[model samples]
Target: MRASAKIFWILGVFFLIVAIAYGFVTGTYEPHGIETVGFPAILALSGLGFMIAMALTLAYRKNSINPSDDLDAEVSREAGVQGSFSPYSWAPLWASLGAALCFLGVAAGWWIFAFGIMFAIYGVLSWVLEFSIGQHAH
Candidate 1:
């Protein structure tokens, strides 16, 4: 995690530098179009990366040690069941369908958007409660 954080931080700094350099080269302080906004947008993305790195670093500090941080750690040492995962599910498909409908609504009509929202809600609820009942109850 420490290593990962460092890499992201470096990337963020590199992007920030590029944005500054681009501003100087282009002689533009304000974005008048997409082309002018590219560097700043990249800078924002890099800042997000840096923020993520910081979060990881904080988490690492709390945990103190991880397999990747140990030079002598073997793959087998870290190999184990990490968490429970559903073997099969239809929620993702439903969610995607809803998303597609929502996008379609954007181009077609508001009625489609309403149906999309309802589908999205149903899909999310079913997905979230999948394990609360039926054969997969837990």
Candidate 2:
């Protein structure tokens, strides 16, 4: 995990540097539209986000109890307490239907990004509702 974090950080820094360079190049030149350079900036920010994810993973790995340790059983019990739902319930159906609707919206030209937002929201809602219902029914 530490190694992965380091790699992510390195990639993030490289991407950030590239993004900065892109800004400079675009700022100095007028060969093409500014929007053409926006993608590189977006890519850089995405790399930075990946770095953040890696950092969080490293932190979690550091704090989590080892499976071979005496605290393993207790840790597992607590983990289970954090989720009392079965994903095998109606969650899959709802999520799949939501995904299909989102896809159709995107295909129909409702806006590509809007479809992504709707899909994400639907995913979260479906998970929450399924978890709640699954736990209660259990």
Instruction: Name the candidate that leads on lDDT.
Output: 1
The CA lDDT at 122 in model 1 is 82
* Worst window of 10 by summed lDDT in candidate 2: 66-75
lDDT of 2 by residue, 11-116 (tens): 7777777777777777678566454658566676867767686775668577754333343355454453544546456655656666777687767766754665
Query: Which sections of candidate 2 miss by over 4 Å?
Result: 31-33, 36-47, 50-54, 57-87, 106-123, 135-138
Tens digit of per-residue lDDT, candidate 1, span 2-63: 88988988988888888777767666544553355776787797789889889988999999
Per-residue lDDT for 35 in model 2?
A: 47
Of candidate 1, the 10-residue stretch with the lowest lDDT total is 27-36
- Which residue pairs overlap in candidate 2's backbone? none
Model 1 reaches what TM-score against the true structure?
A: 0.77
Candidate 2's TM-score: 0.52
Backbone Cα, N, C clashes tallied per candidate: 0, 0
